[model samples]
Target: MLTVLPAINWLSVLVAFVLYFGLGAFWYLFLFPKPYRISLGRSANEPQSGNPLYIVGPAVCSLIITLTSAVLLYALNVTSYGAATLFAAVVGGGYLVTNTVNIAINPNIPRPFLYGLITGSYHFVGLLLISLLLVAMR
Candidate 1:
């Protein structure tokens, strides 16, 4: 499957990765800071500054996820803007949403459905942005 690497747009993948990374930043920082913290059973004001996992884990994971998504998009031959967005919606909704909801249903979850709603929505948005950037860059 990866033998198709030459056909893939590495530049588009990079752009999509960067865009998704930026969206994650704003999504966690400004959009759902308090609610997300509460969902994790943390006080919003609790210090996360010294935690490398808090900072680095997500960033690394985001890059890996974006890379995978880009590979999927390339394999799917997603070309046009409309097709890209549609593919993102279908894949993100079908797979990512289910995964997110499962996390929310975990036995250790603090608040039912709350984190799922936020996290799942963030993933959908990230997928959408990644799609847009990839198609536009093409």
Candidate 2:
């Protein structure tokens, strides 16, 4: 329910979005494609369908996690910009490292580590940008 435009630092948000999107692009282009193809036994060049469930479901989840983390960080009196960045990095990186290991070790799990990677990366990038914004604003 937070009004992102007015309530949050727009510049920071933009930076986070860019960083997270870049990471996603990297993830898809480099880290995930081969593993995903291997796991699903699909051709490397198979066409992708624009499924609503696949897109919207994960997006909603990412939003929830990012917003929740931001709010919680704020509530905990860690609203400083540096704190936000560090929080995002710790939370995001932690989630990624944990999930990456889990998926890498156990490839049988459904959906692999795609969901966690996406969600965690978003949170990480968002928090990092917010933290930068906090510093700039200060």
Best candidate, TM-score: 1
Per-residue alpha-carbon lDDT of model 2 for 34-107, expressed as tens digits? 65554455666776556787656654554555455544554554656667667767766776446554654455
Residue 138, candidate 2: C-alpha displacement in angstroms: 10
Best by lDDT: 1
Give candidate 1's whole-model lDDT: 0.81
* Alpha-carbon runs more than 4 Å astray in model 2: 1-41, 109-123, 130-138
RMSD of model 2 against the true structure: 5.3
lDDT of 2 at 70: 47
Q: Rate the local accuracy (lDDT) of all candidates.
A: 0.81, 0.54
